[model samples]
Target chain A: MTLAIEPITPLPELHRGRSLHNVWARFVNRVAVLLCWTSALVTIGALFLIFGYIVYKGVWALTGLEFTTHFPWFDFTHFHLNATFFTSLPRPGDAVGGMRNCIAGTLVLIAMASVIGIPVGMLCGIYLAEYSKDNLFSHSVRLVVDVLAGVPSIIVGVLAYSLVVRPMGNNSAWAGAVALGFIMCPIIARTTEEMLKLVPKALREASIGLGASKFQTLFRVVIPAAASGIITGVMLSVARVAGETAPLLFTVLGSDQPIFSMNSHFPFFHADLNNAFPSLTAQIYKYATSAEPEWLKEAWGGMLVLIMIVLIMNIMVRVVTAKKMAGRH
Target chain B: MSDLPVMPPAAPLRRRANSAWLRFVDFLTFGGAFGGTMTLIGLLALLIGTILIGAFPSIHQFGFSFFTTSMWNPVTARFGAWPYIYCTLVTSLVALVISLPVSLGSAIFLVKLAPKIRFPIPSALLGKSSPSGWTLLNPRIFVTVTSFLIELLAAIPSIAYGLWGVAVLVPIMQESIQPFLADSVILSDLPLCGWLPHWHVGLYLAHIPGIGILFADPAAGSNMFTSSVVLAIMVTPIMTAIIRDVLAVVPPELEQGALGLGATWWQAMKLVIGFSKMGIFGAVILGFARAMGETMAVTMIIGNSRPSSYSLFSQGQTIASLLANQFNNADTDSERQALYFTALILLMITMLINGIARVILLRVTAGGKHK
Candidate 1:
């Protein structure tokens, strides 16, 4: 090949007419950069606003044993005021721990929902990611999951009201737990499925080459490796459901009694599990409309408590996600 | 015995049984997932069932005019949805107009611009993801919150929103707009503000003609404008988060490649980010879907008027809100069926939205690896 030299253009002077266009271009890029930053800053500011206000309010209300304990008094003067449904505290103090009862109830319902929801979601996710080979079943699951996510909270409430709450009896957390699970399942499944897909096929092949069955490989290798991502997704699902109102409204029937302990009721605790209790979210709804000062304090306090809980969960997810992302790099 | 067994093949029945068992387990696994998926679809059915049971009878009595007629006189048992439908479409359309720019802009800002902006996550978190620790210091909190409040901002429950509109928004709107009217003569001509009742409450004391403003008449319900605000708040977080995520996925490499080729930054983003046609479309569809399914919050603020409105400030009803408010009152069988049909319509809408979103998301992901 014959050797050839390319001519180089001379640099233009900054003050000349030709430079004006360059200057304008540079200015535009700078402004674009500024616009990007401004948007991000504004978004951050909004988050801080939500966090600050909730914490500021939650601090005082989250005090005493009350922060942890206390169920409201559900006086169904017209309904059944059966002693069987009621549980009394040891001390019989002036005020029940407002949040303590709710905290327990919330945990139990959320935990139960999580248990039922997470596995199904993961499996559906697995099928979508692996077995799908991009199948019709998996594709339809995506559409269904999307619809589920968008369904209004009230409609979920109504369905739960019709199915679980009506047939199985009412004024209990089980109904609420099941309803929340119905909605949460779609979100957890869809996200988990997507996250699992992001794991390279090579990793799974490596596990299979070790003479592992698909089940063992999936459980021992793929799952544990994707553990952090799944955890973050689960946490987000929790945070999302934590704010839900209508579903619980129609399902739990809004009890005001101190709920059973979270740990004790696992597997089966008939009396407590069957018992009526309040959720922090449900309480916020009930108390928002009340005329009493004491109730008002509880409502605002509950909102603060809710904000804190959701924020903490969200932050943890973000941190875990960030760490997992960095580890990938 | 060992020599004979060593050369023998395993029994065909046993092997077949084992494979069958394995297949059974797989089927079980798949079924468990599909069952939950069905529940998601099942909810739409339940909602429709409830509404049709409640509203269908009225449809029979009122005929097809049940939808086309605007008059809703309870004493005469006359009913029509002309006004309600008008109000819903108008406000939602207007809301779409106002929010689409801000939300889409915010989405683009978050996706393309967030990296250059430090503390990007916090901004997204401030409203939803994180707590409000940093926001207490910003002066914009006052401005945004006040603006939101004037708009009855954030995810405050519906009851409070309704009360605020009744107690706060009405008087302000009435006083602001009434002064421009030509007393009775000019006011009489305005169809939009025709519903304002003479009664005054809280801050509104004037007997302004036409409910053109907030408290102009305070007829119908206080929710008129209040519901629209609530709807706006309810959908904003959803829009912001989804759009942000969609934008975030637009590869930086693509944008940089354009810029490296001597393209303007605008040109770079347009080519790179704008390529996310499916995602952007999905985000918008999902946003509209969010607005459609929203019930309690919208119910609280929207006037939930018997009839709806033509004007911006009048009470209007949404399909979801209507089902929520009226589903329980239907005692007749067909009355309930009509309500169910409304719910069916709502469900169909939701399904259609999801179906579209699924197609868009799939198409985008299919193209995700491309520059």
Candidate 2:
């Protein structure tokens, strides 16, 4: 005696019957997917739009175009490369010149900030990653670092003003570097800690088993293992501080000449750390807001330069990390 | 015992000497690192102390009224932080509102939809025969490139954004978007309010009281709304990156289970979102804090107007912007102190937001690990 078996049937609502509930659910799903696609496209599109506009306007500015009566079109006859824009000092009083001084000043400021921020940040990160155990002190220190990272650049400027500028009775390059250093410190420390933490425990143990001291192991083995990541972090932090304008507004107070000078006396490579310094971002701000079109053009050019520096650094870091990731595979 | 090798006495001494040197080096490194950590602590204390000491005069003078009153007469030396606080909150809230949906949608697209998406490629182009006529687009590559661009957006300096805002966005807002919005508000009052007024889909939206004022006429284009838009653009990438990270951490098994249970892709996403709601909220809060503290871009376009009405079309000043604009120009010590007081307020607000976000995110990630 055999028992009869029946085939399972689909739910009436869920079948391909074009039921209202099924249709509604499908419609909703389609709409959601469509929205997501549109949003992603829009985000990418917005980035492209920004870059496109910047490049167009920046290129126009770089070529030193003269406005023609053609209304919105520039005379290509005047489209010569503006070499003076990179080589000559900024000309005052309606004269269009270069941002050489400001560029130099910016480079000097970044150098000073890195010098002050990098080692200290790396050491703090080393302590957090290798030495300090989970304790209240370490926890509090981490908390402070997190909080400090969130503090606005303008506030840091104010702090630097009071802590460095007011005591010295002047806005100076030193004060600006301090403000930027403050910004760079927490970022470097955070990244360094994270990168160091990523180094394998087995490697550390191997070094220890080889009779290496903790300090030697960390410096020679762990740090080297994490070097690429640490360097990437440092580069990113430097890029971030490079374009900071608000802090420099209060600290460096823009200058017209280069912030450094050569002296024949002792300390021959003299720096104007005691005086006002110009920076690319701050100078761009000053020029961009001016009523003069030439100044605005220069501002655009300066922006192009600044953007190039930052984007190059970012892309380099990305490429390096990508290579490292690929190599791991 | 007779076969045991003899050890050199000089070798033992050298070994001892090396060990001592290593110990000394270890001590030095430890001391240096500890000093660096202490420096960080000292920096924090110094930051707080500087702001506190600088702000004491205003705090003493105004007492609690500094936060309550709206008056800010520099001539009379009467200062109030209420207006700046209000502006900061309003702008940041508006920015958050504008950015949240976009960021969420993009994040969902990235984590859920990206992997399933495939592009059809012609066999001729590929130089190979394919039965399905499709090629995997490598979601990993797509996601990496998209995220890299988003990060580049964030890497673009605030000052650069300000430059672009002044040169490009402001004019566009003044000429097109603002006028269109204002016109739509008027057009919504017509009989065909529901359908004819294309932009006035916010007809019922205009009936809302306080929010209605936000859709007012465009001034110089450097108004609160414009700044809020800039802030929105500034923060969307950050919020999207964070939300994508959080969403990516949701267990794939949970999503797969939902799908296997005959749920649609959207339904699966809804489940994942519900699971990671706390983390998403934390991302929003972090974005809000960033918007609040953003200075140069907002300052360039916010019109730097002192405390005015709450109209989004009206120019307003935020705490950070106020500090940026006035900190340098303050002629008197009290005036400088007032700016300090504003900075203190801004600091507190940001710290509170960041702290709450950190706690929520920590808990969410920790909970995920436990699961």
Candidate 3:
């Protein structure tokens, strides 16, 4: 068979007008470069501006431990109340109270969420990466994970409210944890999958060649290899959920006094997890919107703590990932 | 070794028990992983199903008019979503308009103009000629630091941004940007100053030919403009990061080919961008989806008022802010149902946006494979 080839068409001449067009093009390129530089500067500057102002305004509240330890008191109507009373929730004009309960409550919520989310997410991720062999089921699961990650957090709140809070006949930390757990699941699972995918297939095959079962190979070799990435993903997921307010809005229901501490209970050691609890994020929303200045100040204090928690977790993840990345070379 | 161990194969019960334990573990782990995957699918279904079921009362009540009617009074039992939808779209649109160029420019700067960084230890660190700290002063360090700060900005909670917006951004907008635009000769002439309560233009500005300046009755603080500004800041990092990643993955050969043809650096970048337009579009849509669902900051800064406006300067409510403000305090069943309906709408929009973004991203990768 004879092969036929199409004739090449002649190309157009260059439109290199030496006078005006060249100048215009040159000017455009220069301006574009300048704008790009300016954009970088603006982005960097914006970050520092937000963080600086927050730290500047929030540092004073943070310096005192009162906000973190002192529960607010409502009835200081009698004379000569204890100085510790100053750490209680703000009265109309007093700024002495702290978000101790909120701090405790946030930790409890996160702990519960981690317990639910981490294992399940890791398992799912391992299955996706090491097993399934890119089946239609696995593809759909991956798609669903991405879509779930984008669900507006408030809708998650609403879901938790209906399923857990409403059914229980009250808002509780349990419901809040569930809502936050839903949010964390997709992030951890997807990250874990990606991290596990980066593990060498040769390692898996070698383990199998050594007569190791699939589970043993995964647990002994693949998982340990991808530990740093999985840990980083876990940290990032925690950071992501730590700042979430909308889900907790309808779930935790924000209490002023500490309710969930084990010491503050009837059994003396058991804490009530299924009760309305304070959270730093929910507290910020509550106090930030209050009519009183003292409450607003407390809100700022809560914001500082919240920011620190999130930023520290994120920075830790960054450091870990960066170190691992450096080690790869 | 065989002589030592061969004597242990006598007990059938023990051997069967050993195999049973192994089988149990095998069954347990495989089942656990499969169950975990199924849980994720179940979680999505429950979330969407609950929202839809919760929203059914209002959806049945309002039917299609829910999209058209702007009325949202709880006292009168009237609920409509035109204003909230309008505000959500307008705020997201405004944020995209403000952020797109900035993020694109910054991404281009990092991906094209920034120097390639090598994570090499300085020679002096190994007791050689170079100084130990020389790498600290590199310009690539500056770029890395900038990018780190951007990521940190992303990590910042929406509430903190809200706090900053309330404390800082609102004042700046009210004092600086608004007034600057109001007074500027060219910008002031751009129809922003005269959008009155009834959508009528100012008679004075209207009478002047080619000058349809629409000055909104400026609220003191916490307006649509402030919320949009915060939203813009909140989303810039996301857009910039995504675009940077997208551009990073664009094969250098595309640019090298253009350069080999004697094209300018700008032209080469333009060609690369042309090739990655779908990816960039996906990035923009992702950013928009993020902007639309952003809650605390927008709610805190957007002045969550009932009355909506056509102008940016007036206080407005997004669907998110509206749901946030009213969901918990909703006294009546219909009121609560209406809020759920709003969430349903927001959910559908976000899902659609993300779905489209994913499709675009897939197409970009598929196209790359062909090239």
Candidate 4:
């Protein structure tokens, strides 16, 4: 249909038809160009609109002090004045609590995820890179990783909640960490394998020539060289885990109370078992869904806080890589 | 048995007992690596197994009936997943259709048309760069600003979409669009012909044919079109991002060769760019997958009123939303099991589709690598 308007074989004939089909030709060309641009623009532009709306609405709720601090402490009179911002200081079980507990829970959960996920993922990467030979089993494993990534995190949450929280009869942070760990491992292993593969065979030969054991060569020689890529994988996984909400919702059984203690005093914080704690993402999910306007504001504020933390982590990764590369000078 | 030759030994053996300790290190490296791999594979199996078990009882009782029944009466022990599955399929498919063209278009422009984006991070950091700029541009695509925006939008709960969809979209799509189409004699006779519900008391009469075509009388809330629109926005960024990554890998030579042959840019793209249909299709499937998986975003906009929908404007229920709305409300084991069966089915379907896509993508990539 589009090809009927073809140009002439020679320049003279092409010129003759120019005026008759000039506007039509230009219009066709314009639409063709616009079609491509519009499609791309729509893709990029919609993201902008969503962000614009979120930030525009959320700005009203954000305050520097509120961001740095947990839910503010206030009495009944203050609560009446700003009915949305609720903080019951004296052991009020369920009014509106600070995010202190959630913050601690998220950190502990993340720490556990790193511990459980990293070593195993790193080893898988090595095995895939050094052994397996992309055999049927290894190929199947690679396929499984993609499938795992596609599995909705909510399923992960449901699974984790059942395995860790429901059986234990408590909403502890440990279960949530395990869920996030499951999500993180496939991604980490793939990245690690790619990095490991980049290490030249000559380096291994050099080490072997010097009478170094294969294990020592891998650990002392290959690993140190590929440290940047491995770390990058960890950093990316961390960023991903931080953004998740569904997994935490079921596993963490988030709390409103401020939990300031970083170390043990909390039995649930131990590595031996699963425990529940609050995370910023989970809190946002709860608060945003609530009817109160004040709660909505806090959800927005919470978003800002979470984005900042993720941003900082990303910057840390970038800066470390940059500095390391520069130091080679 | 074929024995692969090791690199010819180049170094002198240390004449000490400790010299062979290095070989032990090699053994440990291989052992630890394999062990770690087994643990990860075990974790994946464990996760799936755990969920399947929990959902087992429900699966056993309902069998096939669980999918067809919509009673959801926990007090009497009746559970049906028809509504939830319908909504999930409808909403995700709709969103995929809406987002696919735009995402693919954007990806092509950014890759083939737009000038290469240059952000000079120090040169040494560029270890093992791919010839394709697709992966290179990932860092750029991920500038926190984009994700930051997505994160904020993501945090907005689904209920808001419900409130907004009913309040805003139902009226706009009905009031303005429907009446304009009526005077043109578009649909003189259609079942949707009706009066719309006004905010105050009256019904504004609308005469239109199509679901999107405005009618004199507005249809009730929970139309499929409105639900799909809201869902389209939610899935757009995800689809776009994934599409962009896939597109970044297309060889520039394909486009260049087309242009060199004197074909117009558009013609070149249609022929050469379209040939990599596999990757583009993978992207749309990714969008489809995300749409299917998304819970909160579509849940809000979809009018949760049951009795499955054929009209684009009527309310419908999706499987995930149905579970969410009813899980806490379930009083009977039968009811709960029906939900589990539905979820189990959803999980199975998703994994199967994803596995197929991965295989196709791997084959394409491996072929490209070999070429």
Clashes of each: 56, 0, 9, 33
> Model 3: per-residue lDDT, tens digit, A1-329?
88889899999877674657767767877888889889988988998898877776565355433423343533333224233322455344554677766777788889999998998898889778877775778777888888888888888888988899888988888999999999989999999999998888899999889867776788889999999999999999999999999888888888876654467556776656777787889988988887877677677767777888888888888778877776676
Which lDDT tens digits does candidate 4 get at residues A1-329? 56687666665445533574555655665676788678765655654554444544444354322312334533222222222333321123344434545555567678889987787788888888877774788888777767887887667766776677767777776787878888788878998898787778888889878866667677889889889978987887787787776566657756655544346575543342334466777776676656666666666655655565665676676667555545554
Give the total clashing residue pairs for model 1.
56
- Candidate 2 lDDT, tens digit per residue, A134-230? 8888887888888888888998999999999999998899999999999999899999998899898999999989888888799889999999999
- DockQ scores for all predicted structures: 0.20, 0.62, 0.51, 0.35
Model 4 per-residue lDDT tens digits across residues B1-371: 35887788878844553555655766777889888878877766876687677678877777688778766666777677776677677777877787777666665665565653544443336654555532332334433334334433433334343434544556655654433333332332323654533323223333334543323223554455566777776666565565555555667788789779655667777775576778667666766666676655445556566744454555777666555555434566566566566667777777777887777666655565665
lDDT of 1 by residue, A1-329 (tens): 97787788898654542477777977887776676555444444544544454444344344422322332424323233222211332112234335556666777788888877787677667766666656776666677767677776666666665666557665567778877887777778777887887788998898778655565566777778787888888888888777776677657856655554345555554436564556767766666555555555555566766666665776677668756765687
lDDT-best of 2 and 4: 2
State every prediction's TM-score relative to the real structure: 0.68, 0.90, 0.86, 0.76
Please give the lDDT score at residue B26 for candidate 1.
53
**Candidate 1 lDDT tens digits, B174-194:** 554333321233343334656
For candidate 1, what is the TM-score?
A: 0.68
Candidate 4 runs further than 4 Å off: A1-26, A64-97, A260-276, A314-329, B1-22, B116-227, B245-254, B299-308, B311-316, B323-330
- On lDDT, the stronger of 1 and 3 is 3
- Per-residue error for A79 in candidate 1, Å, reads 40
Give the 10-residue window scoring lowest on summed lDDT in candidate 2 chain B. B198-207
RMSD of 3: 7.8
Candidate 3 structure quality by residue, lDDT tens digits, B23-70: 778778889988898999999888789989999989999999999999
| Top-scoring candidate (DockQ) | 2
Per-residue lDDT value at A317 in model 3 = 85
